[model samples]
Target: MNDFSKTDRLMERGSAFLGSRYAILCGAMSWVSERHLVSAISNAGGFGVIACGAMTPEQLETEIAATQELTDKPFGVNLITMHPQLFDLIEVCDKAGVSHVVLAGGIPPKGSVEAIKGGQNPAKVICFAPTLALAKKLLRSGADALVIEGMEAGGHIGPVSTSVLAQEMLPELSQDHIIFVAGGIGRGNAMAGYLEMGAAGVQLGTRFACAKESIAHENFKKAFFRANARDAVASVQVDARLPVIPVRALKNKGTEEFTQKQREVAGVLDRNEIAMEEAQLQIEHYWAGALRRAVIDGDVENGSLMAGQSVGMVKEEEPAADIIAKLMTQSEDALTRR
Candidate 1:
């Protein structure tokens, strides 16, 4: 039987978040957190979140159904708030009986939140907030909980790191409002550490990206396996005037290419050769297609391989179940050692 005294604070919080066995959560990752991966994580006793970026409402419905077919356990659908079909996606999720819906990429639009909260079959709405103010705003605007994401997280990140966000927000937010910590969280020990810091649970994205059940391309996973802690750094401008979102990633062909392109674009804008809007559009398009090629086609060298700094810690691919179990074991071990 599992030992309760050996349970770490994070494990206890995670158990409370899930309201059942296990304190692990499979983070919602773009292009990779599909039905199979979500179901795999959930069935293994962790909360799995399906990333619904750029998907049409109809597409989300099919994916949600596919996930349901794979597991009867609770799972969540992650919606990109900036997506044009955000409202429709919420409708689809409501119809699918999705237990939880996480809104990422900016604060959730009020209309979307109202719809989700007011619907006859309303689902729990979870959103990511960068600061305590944002977290308070989300909760006031109908969010059931918040996933406090730090700059160290993969994909689009906020200005603050998870450490600061947690320190700033957790102290103010009431315990009734669930707060899950995200960014640079990979192992069970890390999860326990956050729990001690007052997080209800930890959301992990990068480590799962390399899991055997993950849909991330083989080359993408290989890059993560090859990464070292030193290899993962946030992007910086080549010139003082030009800056981009501080995305943390492994230094590889894709990252280098993106940085070089940013430098060139900044040069053009500084010289008034290109409009700021035009330069921004070009950068956005480049990243859009680049991420698709890397995630969908497995072209790691040219595609945007988004990952968290914790990626350097990932050495190999294992089944989602094994990863979850190992994390729990590690958390237990950490508690005993303490």
Candidate 2:
């Protein structure tokens, strides 16, 4: 049951909505937020989302069963829309009795929503809405909630920052839908600020990536602890013709190679050496499996170290419960101070 320690009405509602002791959400990280991390967060009284990135149906089922064995609390699963086995993944979640399913990466397929909300299993659908138009469309498409993540976040990001989107979307959308603000959130004060502004809750990935429960390699945690906000830079599109998705990450030799790779691809495109689709694929393939190398294999030098601008705020490795308690206390204090 909710302790109701938070005086803020919005925070209470957020906690109630998620059925968690706290309003905080541990945003799923590709290889990092697996069974161990996900269960720890849930058991600590915060909502945890398992990152189903690139996991097949059978694999996802196994992971879900593993997480269930660890924690009896509510948790969710994050699935990329572009997965080849999208429908199969949904079926796995349904049969696993998953309570929540988050669809990310891109716009979902037509019947995907209906399929998720189908049958005896009751899984709430949460989707990323990049624009107001898309947000309305998703709500109409039966998405139970929306998460607006900005450019400051780690991994693939949009062009806008979190603050601006909160200003632009929260006032109109929050009342009608369960809107969660994400990206660049490192502390409870920032979360409190957003909650006051009408965000139902806040989702954080960068800070949680360093939690003691996290399976991310020690090298990955070290890089996060050592880096500042400025060190985390977003990937840019060197060629306007070749559209490459922007990704925020810590600077390293691999990051520099991305620039060179883009330049080479742009040159090839200009000379008609490759088609537009092929050139885009080349740019995208540069970081394929890079996160796994860093998060799982401890290859910080050459692998992808996806971190938000708030990486500077992450100090040391702490238990998942400690992180949740600190953030909750900070939020309560901020509200009282206001």
Candidate 3:
């Protein structure tokens, strides 16, 4: 491996935490982040997280085993906090001896962290904190690290932009805790700025979703190659009371369809056909299914083309190793120029 002294220096804390050569993490994208891409990222010296999106414990176990077969390097598992079988999935990770667990989609429902950390082999718990206060609270709540993703990211996102979240959260928590800044990060210079601001590392989703190793469909990758920043738009909340989190994706018939789906779910919610938790899960399930359609089934026009604003930077298919090397080289060059 080439010496990236400056970049490595800045990434020291995060690298140590993730047990990877670089602090870069591949943001877990449902179908795209399966064994192939995840192992490729880890083999490339960056951390790869398995997206255990809506997967049952048995499935997560099989994925973990498959990923381990591909790479001995460390990686993490991203589990949805709201998954009905959250604890069972945690057990699968525990049995697999996974190193890190990222809890996303909401606050770690009480004891979820404990359950993750309590196994014979404890895993570091990484949580998503959208705000400064929540960052502190998660840190205090036994979270080993935090990823502050902004609205600029693909899929479900918070209201703030990456720049704003970095300025707000990095200085406050980065000194004493491990914090990874994500969202709208497409290049190395942007990464350099965050490291200078005390970010432990960075996470990127859209940038890697179409890597040569990713299993995303050809149509899905083509849509990303053809898209611009403006093409990636966030879905509008059809009803405020439904507790729907806005999703960012490429505009298509599916985008409009989601609004209608939300309305339909809201009607069910209104009629008390399902409880609030069930309603929320219904919406999440919709996204998972839609994403699979685009990523796995090549239904880009009707499936959810979840992408970050960085989609504009993805020019073509490249090996994961080349991608990591390029980003690290660029980051090092930027640091040196400074």
Instruction: Find the candidate with the highest lDDT and give its number.
Output: 3
Rank candidates by lDDT, best first.
3, 2, 1
Clashing pairs in 2: none
Could you give candidate 3's per-residue lDDT for residues 132-196 as a string of tens digits? 98888898899999999989999999899999899988877889999999999999889988999
Score residue 173 of candidate 3 by CA lDDT.
85
lDDT of 2 by residue, 256-289 (tens): 7788888998999899998886676555456657
For every model shown, what is its TM-score relative to the native structure? 0.87, 0.92, 0.99
Question: Which candidate model has the greater TM-score, 1 or 2?
Answer: 2
Off by over 4 Å in 2: 1-4, 260-288
Give each model's whole-structure lDDT. Answer: 0.78, 0.87, 0.94
On a 0 to 1 TM-score scale, where does candidate 3 land against the true structure?
0.99
Once fitted onto the true fold, the runs of candidate 1 whose alpha carbons sit more than 4 angstroms away are: 4-20, 236-244, 259-286
lDDT of prediction 3? 0.94
Compose the digit string of candidate 1's lDDT tens values, residues 1-338: 56644554445655665654665667776678999899899888888998887678988999999999999998888887767668888889888888788887676776998888777677888888887777788888888878888887887777788887887887777456678888888777877677776777778888888888888888888888988766677766576565455666666688888888988898788789977656765665666677778887998888888888888779999999888878877777776788
The TM-score between candidate 2 and the true structure equals 0.92
